[model samples]
Target: MNTPQQTESIKNLVENIDKGNIVLPEFQRDFVWEIKKTCELFDSIVRDIFIGSIIYGKPTFEITVREIDTRPRKGQGSRRKLKITSFDKGEINQKSQISNFRLILDGQQRATSFYRALKGIDEIWFIAKSEDDLDNEIKTKEYKDRSLEEMLYTFSLQEDEERISIKLSEAYEISKGDMFDEDIKENFFDNLLFVVAMNDAELKDNFRRYKTLCMKLGELFKSELLLSYYLLNMDNEKFALFFERSNSKGIQLNFIDILAAKLYKGFNLRDKIDELESRYPNFKFDREIIVRTISYIVSNGKDIDRNYILSNLNYDHFNLYWDDICKYYNQVLDFLFQEDLAISQNWMPYENMVIPLIIFLRESNQNDFSQMNEWQYEFIKYWYWASILSQRYSSGSNEAILQDSNVLKSIAKGIKITDRVFFTRLKSQIDSYEDIFSYSRKVNVIYKGILNLINYNSMGLTDWNNSSKLSFSKKLEDHHIFPKEYIKQQFKNDEQAISLMDCVANRTLIPKITNIKVGKKKPSRYMTELKASNEKLDSTLKEHLVPTEIVEGLYDEFFNEFIEERAKLIFDLIKKTIIEKEKQIIDQYYLAPRVQGNIKIFATYYSKKLEATLDVDSQKVLLLGESHSVSSAADKAKYTLSGKGDTSTNGWRFWKYIDNNGQERYIDEFRK
Candidate 1:
């Protein structure tokens, strides 16, 4: 049992790979390193940088293995046939091959990269004989304009000494030959000496200096201490653990990689994911989502975390549920598109939300949302909106998925889910939107949720000029109501003013043509022009939740007020259509008992005094003559607390109230 670290030369490593003694395990991911990375690896090796050690495991049991893909990249060269061979412990022992055979567990990408470059299989590699030669090449007209990538790939194995480069494969072959062979040594050193003599006269005159440099260049390819490795002698179970632990550092192996390796005997998780991707090319299904969904369903929603998926998700469970899950997943996509929640995968507020959605669809045994009854359909819609608006799937999402899946499954079974916390959270999410401001250009889930809501309310965003509804195929732009340049000119150095300029409330989707016409113009100017040109312009602006007052008011003086007014309009629209429409279902299923006489007053003070009455039925705070969720109210309270004018406040934690037992507690306690 050779369980010790070892060293091998680049020459021997490439040879062992060619002889099929060193092979990749069947579970290893494909060589995904780019050509630039391969070039960097070679550059590091030549410069003698520490490139890290490879780790291999010699299993005591049978396992599948494959030959490395030595074929050149497409269009770079022709493809070669790969001969994949399997070996068992018994066969290796019988054939006296135990000393030679090993499965690469770590550094697969690096090892594969070295083999491809050293063997000249993918792209032919080359080395400059001298730095003078490199400098000369860089100064040439042909190479001077080339990028680093072009220079690296363009240098070929030229016979001309003036070119001052040697094929790395040719150099390695000569260097690895017997040093005592005068002809081989002479040929290798002569190539280096010739380039130096032509390029560097001073170094060429100094015989010792030129000879030392030439010998160092020749010895680099055959240096025995260059490539280091560690070998592990272990059984299959230990080998799997060792592989995972070894790769748990930099560029750690993901769950999909570990699961694929563990389930290699009966299934290839990665290949299955690839198949799903190919089958549903229109939908961008993340690989992690697919694996986690499988884990969620197989474990019956007990867990879908990385460790659980790696250890518990097996081939049998995957085989049984995969086809049905795929069917349900397709239906989920159809539902998303049909409901206008997402036109493309990027538009989805949370991609992993698909897990719970799929669970509900599968448990209900429905092909699509069309098969659902009115109550069921409404429940799912509300759930989707609440999930996105609350940013529920933002972090620690697996637990949320499990919780929501159970609630949805119960719904599927005709069980009333009388979860008070769930409805409160839903109502809070709706109320929170009243003061929400999101940077429209950023990757924000809340921003996307608001846009989706607006799209849903409007049927589709309409062109301000033609009044045609925008679709997925049409080019749409989020046009700022007050042009960005105009706002910047007026606000100058005000960060809050600039931020409000880009707020989602101040932006609306219009066709590219409409955007061009509206460019760099004040909203007042554009809206006035639009009103005169288009008869239905007022209705179009209303559809987009844009206030008509912007058409007449001076924006520079009232920009903040305009944003607030428009945000209120957007919030009112979503509340009236989405939230209030589903209020009955929420009231019947998830409402908590209303405390009539014992009304709880929550208060928080920062720079000023603030107070609110908790309306438990509406799940809102009556603060300063306006209704807001605890979160939004907290944000409003924080607006004047700091010179920076930060408004993102976690209201549940900020606002405090006395519980029924006379203990002061945060408003977040109600959620628990």
Candidate 2:
């Protein structure tokens, strides 16, 4: 049955969404409107244009529901309390007991867009009288100078006598008049340029303009009746049929959304994913990766594409392997951190690489890289480099990834297969390294991979001016060796100059502080200044893979030669770091007839020494009448020395021995 149509002010509608009086059905698709669409909704609202009508269903039977998307207030927990109603269709004597909440059947996107904007959920929404006014606000020293293109609402302001704009949320609050907190006045003043104004007349003019904008926004939210809805009184079957019919013309749900809806009866996939995201707040991999990973594991490496997942994935299988997936995922993160492959999600070249890695880690049953045998460790390392350099996962790479996963599984079982076409492709890709350019680190996998390789080779990049180590703790950026402006001045064609300037060979990671010092200056000048300030300049430059011989002559005349020489040098470093290093480890520890080493641990309170013998072919260590890998041996020593457990130590770097020339060196030095 149809109820009478009703209209609600935008302000009341937003308040209902915030207070949980309005919610969404479990089967409903998520809010998928892009920022542009959300901005357009706001534009229409301010212009007093009718957007559309919402449909709300009052369920006579019990149904699963979720709250509207809104940012949680301070002290609120991870999730809002979900409302579950208990009712029998025949037992309801009065219409008042039906339920206070209504399930949104239509206009979900429009309602969510307005709610999120008004509540300042993901990004702050603001309105200005003119583009010039917004531009002026952006020019204020306090503004971060974000790109207009990146913003949802594109507007800019110049320094003008009149500057007026109000944050949408604050406008809504002020529209309440007596309910507005007096303390919020200061915040409103701070959002404008009046905070630093010296003249009282100018301050009054700005204040007057601010009030006008706020009042306009307030009127738009309070007086304008923008939301109209049709209330439906329907049973479960009818409601389901109506929902299906209503959404027929809407955007189709993706596979993940369908999977979520199907699995919700047995296991709440969305809740589990939300829990995982809460656990690892820094992880940036999207929901697809998580779902695909579960599907891949449950399918036993058969296929993890969308069709396979949709066809075969079930709640029982997902619940069974979810814990192991989480554990292996953590190990993959640790591996990336320890190897300096990626400091964070933004630096990762191919995030899908996590799929194969998780697979390998689970099949091998290895806790960490330090516990791996030489062959297992080397194979994974080679595979990682090859996949990234060859862009193996760039496009339709599901088959390639499946094959690689199979290979990794075989290697875990001690079978070394060398004749794969992937390796040949990897070799060809590496040979063409110089042709790759560093356009955008966020988009270009090769550029990031090359930077990661350089960081791996250097162990850690060093500061250019100061000899301090560059870590993720400090702000790091990929900077050009020869300044961009200098290169532009050298070449008559702008395109050629930018091409040469942004080459992967010409870029290196340095601390942001160092980059400021090297700004727009010729390499020769910066190198000269750096050499004078730091005693170990040559060594630091070498760590960044910058050839010292070319630094002085890196002007326009020698630019091509410099790039060629540096590209070759970088290739050599990559080979030594990824390829030659693994082989050297195999030759030194696994294949060698005999090898011995001792690790000395010196603490503030005590000192101790441990001796170990490497077992050839197995890569296990013999220490204290027990067999262990070098990593376990080191862990044992650390526990003994520090009286603490849960020590994850890299044994190769910890263990050391004397060589033929009577020089002491780390066991890992053998890889050199």
List, residue by residue over 156-246, the lDDT tens digit for candidate 1.
Answer: 3222232234545555555554544456435554545233422233323323332333344456556764455435664343344444444
TM-score of each: 0.48, 0.47
Residue 417, model 1, lDDT: 64
Q: How high a TM-score does candidate 2 get?
A: 0.47
For candidate 2, write residues 117-184 as lDDT tens digits: 67766343453422212333342322223332212232111111122445676667777785443355
Residue 452, model 1: lDDT of 71
Instruction: Give candidate 1's TM-score.
Output: 0.48
lDDT for 525 in candidate 2 is: 79
Off by over 4 Å in 1: 1-253, 427-434, 438-441, 473-477, 493-496, 510-517, 524-535, 549-557, 577-583, 591-672
